[model samples]
Target chain A: MLEARNLSVRYGSLTILDNVSFAVGDKQWVMIVGPNGAGKSTVVNAVSRGAPYTGQILLDGKDIRKYKSTELARKIGVLAQDTPVGYSFSVEEVVGLGRYAYSGGMLSSKSSGDAEFVERALELTGLKELRRQSILTLSGGEKQRTFLAQVLAQDPELLILDEPTNHLDLVFQKQTFALIKNWIEETGRSVISVVHDLSLAKAYGTHALLMHRGRLVASGEIPDVLTRENLTSVYDMDVHDWMRKMLSQWEDGQSGNLPV
Target chain B: MKKREGFSLVTYLLFTLAVLVTLIFCVCAGSVSVPVKETVSLIWRAILGAELPQSTAKAIILNVRLPRVICVGFVGASLSICGAAMQGLLRNPLADGTTLGVSSGASIGAILAIAFGVSIPGIEGGGTVVMAIVFAFLALMIILSLAYKLDYTLSTNTIILIGVIFTMFAGSIISLLVTFAGDHVKSIMFWTMGSLSGSSYGNAVTIAAAFAVCAAVLLSCARELNAFAISEDNARNIGVNVRRVKLIVLIAVSALIGVSVSIGGTIGFVGLVIPHMTRMITGPNHKKLLPASIFAGAVFLMLADLVSRVILSPLELPIGVVTSFIGSITFVYIFYSSRKGRG
Candidate 1:
């Protein structure tokens, strides 16, 4: 299980996240949904220890702050939104870096089991064919999958992703979500993802947290937190009717696109 | 895994062979034209238990050319290794020994020592070796202090700009000292233009020792440098102490460049160009790049020194001129090829 209590983040004199608290139980798939500037990414960043925040984050009932980086890496895997360019590492080499925290200071030497895990990560991410290609030559969606492969190679008990579908096409987005969903279902790992697309959140998420102005306005099961009224109130846009229609169509095996 | 290891081992063996062949050719082919048999005998006699007459052949082969060749090789390896480390630390392919202000600072120190003839207090009677080490360390200190004041992260543009400005500052001071001290002007000029004519056994030993020490220090941090090759935030996330690693690398590179400049006199472009060529052939992993660069750089300088001596026969040209001319042409070729590959 992963939990946060009274998480607050401030940059200089301005506060980005104020008193945000939430928890995801074991084997739960939680999605954080919000509009722009809602501090959704900040919450994820705080939980991952990427930024300084005044709060307590616990992994498996132990305070995460007390754990060393290698220990933390063993427990949780985090993928931030920003993807760097100009790196010349091949796909397999990049995935191999995921084993760095576990390589125990001898990064060049690999155990036979570590190699198998890296191969399995490539297979799971559907990137076995592109394993030897340089990372700089990959398309954006392929790059995202490469990062996903790296995180999966880490084999963490908890997975955290920030805007994992931003640069992906529709097909890639669906494939990626399906991959994550299947992994979580098979391994019974806890997942927390910051998502911008409400449809993706409704489709794959088991639990949802709604944020507005850096504070959580709703948190519960997907049906309870992603209702028509809550969407309208938080986004300040009238999507209630459109959401209801899309929900029904999605239920009936029809496309879920709504007119703008 | 087996294949990759085998390939890397083959490459390493080939590079070692190339370096050995180049070193022998460089030491053998000079202007004086000592016969191969006599040169080999002279070298064997010097190393083993034999008595060879001190003729012009033995003097030229053993006393003059051998030390110069050794000095050139050591300087080349040191400068190129420092360039590789600096580029990795700054996360820029264009960073070099001079980009971080080490060359300019060392040149200034050498010029001051030449013009004013000020023997430092501690090493007043220790001759040129002590003076060189002192000046080199002083230059390193200045550059590191300035970098610290400017907030450890110096952008590529800022670093280049500062390099130019500091070079000008040091050059002006040297010029002022030269105007007042008329007798030492020629020596100072020769040093500034970059020459290996003054290399001796002392210089060879000092530079070799310093290079070995500095190389070991930098190689020990290869993993940290590799983590830095990704990104600072990513490196930090993986528990690398980014600031401390940067400081150690900066000091190591500065010291390496300083020692080279003190020995070989401001030879440029090998530090900048050799690492890039190594990266092109061996990929950007520092583990391979650093060792390959050392070998490539040593061979390149050895060949350049030979050309400098033999091209003009009786009149020896400064090795710097030969290196800069060849290095620029090679740089242009590399730039064109990389662009073409991209296109």
Candidate 2:
């Protein structure tokens, strides 16, 4: 479980996140939804202990800042919105980097179990076939999968994902959420994800948090917080009509052909 | 898996062998060429504590060639390691000591010593190296502080621009010192342009000791460097202390460049070209690339030193000049080829 209290982040005079608070329960998938620049990514970064925040973030009843980096890493795996890699590491090598903290930052220090974890992650993410390929040569979708596999290889108690499905195809997008859902069921672990796909969030999330203009507008059960009213006000648009229209079109068997 | 293992093993052996062969050849083929067999026997005898058969050859090997060869090897290794670390730290393949103005700043320090006759006690090879190291560290601190003040957004363009400006600033100061030196300008210029022929045992030992310490620190953090090659934010998420890693890398790399320039002057291409070439073979994993670049750089620079001394016989070419010529050609070729691949 994770809890963020009165968290605020600022860059010079600009306040990116102000007094935001949220809690994720055991095995819960908390999907954070917001318009552009609503500080969705900032919240994830704050939890990762990368960005300095004014307030406290507690993981399993302990302040996240109190934990050593390697300790935090063993418990939390993060897939940030933009993971920019410059090198041409092989897919296997990239995935193996997930074991860095555990392996004491040396490949020679890795145990047999770490290799198994990497292989398992590669297989789960459908990247086993491309394990030997250069990561620089991967397509957008393949690269995303590779990074996701890396996160999986960390084998953490919690997963923090910001836009985890951005570059994924429809099939892998579904597969990714399914994999996370399976992880929750199997290990009772939690996931905090910032996603733009409202439909997927509504379908898969156990809880939802709506943010608007650096403020948390709503937070509760997914169906409760993702109501038409909260959706309309947070986005500053009429979403009820759009939802009804889309639902009716889907019911009429005409939505499947819609282009991505 | 087995094939990959074999490939890396072969690469390791090839570079190790190349460095060894090049070292022997460099020691043998200077202005006073020694026969290969004779050179080997002399080295063997020296190692065994036996008196060398020929006194003149012994003097050449022990006094002149051996020290120069050792200095060149360590300097080459240090420069390439600095290059690899800088590239990873900045996440820009083009980053090197020369581009970052560390070398120019060092040259200014050395040239100032030549101009004003400043010397530090206990430092071997005169005050040139001592001053060079001081100025190199100053330049690094300035660049680091500038980047930090700008909120640490060290974009590739920003870093390159800053490096270029710093280089020009250092260059002007060097020019001022050179103008003031008058008759000593030739010596100052030669030092700046890089020449290993002037190296003595004291200079070699100084560089070798500093290089060993710096290389150990850098190689120990190779995994951290690999993480840094990606974005700093990602490295942090993966449990790396980005700020700490950056600081360590900066210090280690600066020390490497300072010691190297102290011994070999601002040898241009060993740092810039060797890492790029080594990465092509090692696939950018710093664990392998770091050591590979060190050996490859040692071999390449020793060979260049050999060519500089041997070609034109008695007249020595500035080692930097030869490296720059080879480096520029190779750089252009790499650039165009990579661009063509992209297109």
TM-score versus the correct structure, for each prediction: 0.84, 0.92
Residue-wise lDDT of candidate 1 within B194-215, one digit each (tens)? 7887788888887898889889
lDDT of 2 by residue, B242-280 (tens): 778888888888877877887788898678899999898
Chain A superposition TM-score per model: 0.91, 0.89
Best by TM-score: 2
Q: Which candidate tops lDDT?
A: 2
TM-score of 1: 0.84
Error of 2 at A159 (Å): 1.0
Question: Candidate 1: deviation at residue B152, Å?
Answer: 11
Question: What's model 1's lDDT at B200?
Answer: 88
DockQ-derived CAPRI band for the predicted complex in model 2: medium
Least well predicted 10-residue stretch by lDDT in candidate 2 chain B: B1-10
Q: For each candidate, what is the lDDT?
A: 0.76, 0.81
lDDT per residue as tens, model 1, A1-260: 78899988999898889898889998888999988888999988887777799988887788987877767887888776755633476788777767666756433454457787788888888788898889878878788888788888888888888988787776666677777887887799989999987877887889999999888899989999988789999989976566555543223322221111
Look at candidate 2 and tell me the lDDT of residue B102.
89
